[model samples]
Target chain A: MGKYRPGRRALTGATIVAAASLGLAACSSSGSDDSPSDGASAAGGSDVELRLAWWGSDSRHSATQEVIDAFEEANSGITVVGEFSDWGGYWDKLATATAGGNAPDVIQMDQLYLASYAEREVLSNLADYSALDMSHLGDSVLGMGQVDGAQYAMPISTTSFTLLVNQDVLDELGLTLPDTDAWTWDELGEFASSVTEASSGDVVGIGPMNNEYSLQLWARQHGEALFTDGNVSISEDGLASYFQLALDWAQSGAGAPADQYSEQAALTLDQSDFATGKQAMSFTQSTQIAAYTTASNGANLVPVKIPTEDANATPYAYLKPGMYWSLSSQSKHPEEAAQLIDFLVNDPAATSIIGTERGLPANPDTVEQLSGNLSPEETKAVEYTETLDPILGDAPEIVPNGASDTDPLIQRYLLEVMFEQSSPADAAASFISELQSSIDAA
Target chain B: MSLKELNALAANRSARRRSGGKADTRDNRAALGFLSPWMLGIVGITLGPLLYSLYLSFTNYNLLQSPSWVGLDNYERMFGDERLHQALKVTFTYVIVSVPLQLAVALGLALALDRGMRGLAFYRSAFYLPSLLGGSVAIAVLWRLVFGASGLFNVILGLIGIESSQSWISNPDTALWTIILLHVWTFGSPMVIFLAGLRQIPRAYYEAAATDGANVWWRFRHITMPLLTPIVFFNVVLAIINSFSNFTQAYVVSGGTGGPADSTLFYTLYLYQEGFGNFRMGYAAAMAWLLVLIIGAVTAINFWLSKRWVHYDD
Candidate 1:
């Protein structure tokens, strides 16, 4: 202990990098001492402990646990250990676990990170697991979980992005939505103005929609993509105006003031401007309509298609998975994990327990079966997506490898533009360049 | 008597040497046994990861895949990365502004407490409370709520007929200042140290100066200031280093986005965002090592400056 051996220390230091990486590679080889146990469980009908992880609220957790209990009861040879966290902590924990070679068997995946994980080969090919029944899920829905034309994950539920209008807010202000079915950004702005003026500035019309999804829709409405063919294709000027929309609203008193809007960015869903009746409309995933309704004390929120300025553009809206069930490539029990996923998606027992909690069912038959069981808001959310199916846009290629950073990247520039720290053109240029570099680096 | 003591010490040194020193050998083994737990932690837990991260700095190591060597690419990117520069600017401003202000508040409080006042212990503990919690996520969250729009600060301003709805923590121009204020609020640790240093100053110095018709200001300037120089220097160096590495307060206040246009992006938080948020572990590792170098250089500068102002009895 007292002796100094710099050479030995350096040698050990070098081996650590090798050894640490070797540990990850070794996880796949199944050569570690614990592999025998993991392998035996996978290879045989021996009782297997399949660890499932997800992120959700308390209601979702209780429902998921209830379903897990039913699944365990049905499958005698398997016991599922369900671990859950809030949304923010879930990804970090998953990444850390995957890196440490201790990832769960089944993971609730988000579309934003699906490609990132799949491209990195952390997720198993869904095709390899034959027990999972996904035939009822159409190609468009399945494509959302695909990378390089191969399914790497399964969509748990389908959700579409929509602009939600608070009918109650409009009713209180003694105003009406102006033919919202096929509105433009100008119409959106005008409607917001009418609400603000009608309410004497007590209730702003819309909260900030300068986020990634809003920008994506805006780009698609112009027949482009912020991410095109694995690159950011939107020009700086186009990007500028997208950000400038929120700033215009902020200045025109159609949206919350700059400070208030930015502060509201940090708030939880229930405390958001729309939820608090401070904004007449806001953008959200259709799946969140139920959550918003609950948060706003049943505001009678209605989902409206995203607005477009150009008459010639294609449908800019697409259904995204509420979350996906992905099998970890490092899982010792891939078959059992697939079985669980199939059960969760297909079994009436599981569906009845989970009833639109994860979102409306991803499969057509399951949706039909659960239509009667859905909560009032869930039925509306499901019905809204169903009505828009014919007009939904072509699914985007699974987002690029580094596209998971879209939210924070877009958010930073959104704030910069709104605060006038940088002109919209400059902010757009910076954002595009930054996003491009990240994509290229990835 | 001194000659005998010197002989005894020499004989003891000889006995402690490695010539048939069985007792000393046993003592060494016992010493090693005592240190084994800590030694294992230092090597396996600390050094292993430390060296791994150093190696990772030179590689493209995303957590999803094994790292491949990228040489100086990550390090080279730092010079061109504008966001890194902003993070550096924020960190430098925070350390520069907050440390001096915090030390001043701590010193003032320490001096105030130095007087033999009623319930000195109570005041000391009360002042020290914030230091214990200042870096905690809970207090940082509370800080966010307190400075948010329509928060207590704005509500208080309204009471005085000065209406404001500005969210101090969300505005980029004022965001870093709120964090600086959070840093300054944790003056207790330095205050306690200053209190101890104040006690070390002999009361006789003040008495002697007073007898010579020195006023309170003169006594404080001549007797107290010189004696407190070492403590002041210590606090300055520590505060600078601590504030430079500050993360929790900014992280919590910014909601982990470092936002309102990246104003509150501490270097550590930026590194975390790069490493975990974007999966740019290699770049993040390089950033972390750079932070170490930056903190090292700053501390060295502080030590160098200390030579000019530090007063020691020797």
Candidate 2:
């Protein structure tokens, strides 16, 4: 009887533990109902503590943290707590927090979600942010933060899709560097093949992740927009050409072997075989170039423009803001937050401290103020931009509502093709059908 | 009978009854007091949101806009969605292979460590440490590095005169298996449970079997096997539940794509990608409910089967 009593007690104990565990996990996993986005506040002059959330690598985190510290030091009344994570978990955590009504006061907004967040009314409109004299900022960069005639976020520094080359690999093959301004794919492919042949199995010619976005640069250079008004705009032949180039590189031992494509399919620019010197070339953004340069011995790296499909093809390089910062509508201190953003964007001291870390400064005045303090690599990148004369495209259209969800569906098809299991014909068909179905459902 | 004897007997009976009733009341109050935090938590948090999600599972919830009731529309869509089918296939394969393999290895390890060895705690802790970090971001990242095409594993093979081009985690044929191996490697938690079960068996049973001239194998077959059945059942149930719901490892290892054509797409990862990544919260809610049902049914089946085989010695 006594034993049975203890067992009954144990069951009660187990129930308690289970309930508590569930509560804690639930709280951790979801957004707070009390989050300020919808505008409810407990009565108090109690000093406000706001969380500022972002995703970045260590350097960005540290630099942003320093800037936050400066903001706090200058504005003694408000305390800002920063919440950060790497890219993989950032959105999940952010969404969970947002749902729970515990969203951060200031959010680092990706272009992909800027429109979605705005449409959902989760983001505060920044119509008055323009009043801060951001006219000094690059209009091209600022354009990305605008969606449907409303500004939901302020433009941060800007970057463009660019290419990185291994100069040592080029030299080893007795090949001169391709002219950044006038290079074509046939010229580059021949150079790539020569480099691969000379490396004697030590290096491959190129390594691109199985991403449609990476191919968009070349597609854009041919004056083909990857998507237009909810439809894929690139021709079937264009996709075939893109895949064929990748297949040719693989077959010629100038790129990752077919079996190894999966390994490289999902890599960030940092872990790319090119960055680690396992390959000769990689396509990425100017922001990502910093990672590749820092990861490799500096002597062999060079920033170059992505080549055009043909001689007459435009050297299309879309320069746009990498991300944006926005004050939440729920924030009681929007005025103060706006002031901090202005300081971060246009102040000479903050610009110098931040440098091109966020990318090139979006503020034209800040760019002018900070140019003297730019690192050699950053300066080289800025100089390389002028030489490419890239045909600037419009800011990627606000990734349409639910398009963020559908982007990976497209990538999956591309990956299947790249790994040699599927033809581009089958891949494109499946991708278009799948995405269309999803879009229709949405 | 004498008056004193009669008085003593009456007093003893009354004392016994009073004590029993008092203990019952005390236990009732104490149990409620101890459970106050949990009762509050469940009503305020778990039960509240779980019921809300149950409502959402039936709705057309985009999460950005308020959820609208859609009467099984989400469930209906799931059957037609190829991604959901693919996710189910991947998740089932992961659970079916990883759970049993993990238990088998854990049981083998527990048997090996049953001997009271020197520095036992150190060995136990060393073996158990991976379980602590089994779901961590670092381990997932390490999994990528070790299984990468030009990684330490391939480099080691090259040193031993073997040519290999296997990027195990990224290879569609092999990515799922790499994740299974990672799941199996964290068998320490179950091993510890098995160790506690081992200590509960009476030494006399083995001794008596030995006196019957039974060898070590026979003794173990008769003694240890039956004695550990309950714990084995417990571990199997727990492991299957844990394995079926794995997310972080797959999420991180696959770079949140669940790629190589969704080969490493565990069920929970798919749910998360749908819910959070795609913002198909209603569809994701449906997936989550399905997971709960599947896990619950499997566990119930396990318990029913355990009644036949799990010997709990009195």
Candidate 3:
């Protein structure tokens, strides 16, 4: 005990401090460390080794492993080595690997970097591959992965922007929220203020505007497209109104405190305002109820239609592909890669393992199969996704090629407004120009 | 050696080379043979990238495309780039404020630990612990937890009747300071160096001064300070250059957005964001060159100004 006691507690202190940064250092270097001669092998031979990389959660990783196991059992001779990363560092790893021509066989693609990677020809066009199958998926689902009429990726799931109501917070306060389906943004704000008042400032109504989706939805509501025809089309006024809602909420005591909001902006889901039970509601993706349920310390959250200006607008929301599977242009085994992706999206055995972990499956057939057996939180995600089908407008435009940099830009302006360093109008004006230039440059 | 001594040695080497022919030539050939691997490594790995990046600094390369020549365009943009200016300002503040404070703390600790005391190894390793872990992402996350709203920091504040719930690391006014504090907290490496310098200082001078009725302050000022100037200069140069290159601490601490409003936007973090995050490799290269120039100029100034105050035995 004495020998162990010397380092036992001291090691814990050092371990806690040295942990997270090494993960990133390892990830950034892995691209260079991997065999540069990758993808030059596995030419339709038995026991083909393929690398499949994606950014996701622990649950998603396990589910993906299960899918891979199922796929391997069903189709022998092909092996998939999985590469996973958190979302923050994923693109850096993917881009560096893809640029070095050592990209994994199957690459998980995001809408932000999708067009850029597609235009760069780093992703293989699925249309040219005969082994791939997308016939079961609808035209919209197919179009989600198309850039300028070329299918470069296969959409895995569909999701919509939504308002997640934390029933546990309301129950704790002995209060009820307003009708989420037809409420206006202002009415939502008022309810938030009431929650703040009832809880004596312990909790707020809505979380901070850290993510980009809320702003996009607001722009569309005001008859502006965030990006149209490869350019930023949202007006300064439309954007300011979005920022204004955030500022107004903070000042009105209907939102998380400015510092708390800013802090929450960069925190993990488990530490988020809504997840930590410090907020009654959150504007997030429809598929998030499952994740939020887990993140929120036993907070029973329900995903519902987001509040609008009039509430009667058809397509009060818009659906977007949650993620896509892009076959690497460098992949020597594109046929095998496509078969694996096809299995993940359309096959019942794979869908059973996946459930709503990656949002509702893009294929209607898989979505139907998942509905009866999903976990309660996953069911909430599927049910909420179903409720949006009638009201959701045409699938939103794919993020522009160069607009991947705009997320940080949006957060910057959002912070500026929240901090009172800049007015909403001023921040919006700067953001618009910056956004336009980045898109133009890209 | 001083610059004058270095020049004299070079002159001496050349004279020896001119007079002593065969034996020197044989030695040179052997030296070249021994140096071949390192020369190859430098050329292949280090020098190649350095020269390529210098060329890339003038082009418009985004890692995905052919680097089109756009002479001075990247440099021209850096002049007007507000975010780049902000990043420069943040980096300069971090270096200026943290380096002296860090040196002072390191010097203080080194002096205190210089005295033979009980459990010296334990104390030394414990103090050196933060230096090892401070720059890591885990420590930054733990830092956030410590200074978070309703975190231990606020709880400590509460105990002293200072009622506040602001997350120190998240507040724009205080975020930079928190990072600077982290920088200062990693004084272990410098402290160890200072301790080594202290050990190298002879006790004869202090003993002589003590016999002359000199006080601790007088002895430290006249004898110890002069002897330690070289180490102090070395530490200053290293610390300044290191502070400029610091990325991980700020990148991880600020969650890579350089926020609560670009307050912790260290220059290397910005360069990394441009090169890797934004994929503007050309601009990043230009920024990297600019950083090299800044560090070079500052180091040159340090060497030039060292003539006035840096003491040497010669």
Interface DockQ per candidate: 0.26, 0.37, 0.22
Output the lDDT of residue A373, model 3. Answer: 84
**Model 3 stretches astray by more than 4 angstroms:** A1-31, A36-45, B1-26, B117-119
Indicate the residue-level lDDT of B16 in model 3.
81
- Report the error of model 2 at residue B98, Å: 2.2
Best by lDDT: 1
Q: What is the lDDT of residue A46 in candidate 3?
A: 60
TM-score, predicted candidate 1 vs. hidden true structure? 0.91
Chain A TM-score of each candidate structure, as shown: 0.85, 0.82, 0.89
Winner of 2 and 3 under TM-score: 3
Give the CAPRI class of candidate 3: incorrect
Error (Å) of candidate 3 at residue B162 is 1.9
Candidate 2, residue B189: the lDDT equals: 94
Backbone clashes for every candidate come to: 0, 11, 0
Please estimate how well model 2 matches the true structure, expressed as its whole-model Cα lDDT: 0.73
Candidate 1 on A23-84: residue-level lDDT in tens?
Answer: 22211112122322453355555978888999976667888999999999998888898989
Model 2 lDDT per residue over A21-138, tens place: 5333522244345544322233644455666788876667787788878878876655667889876578877776666556777888877677667777877777675434567655
DockQ order of candidates, top first: 2, 1, 3
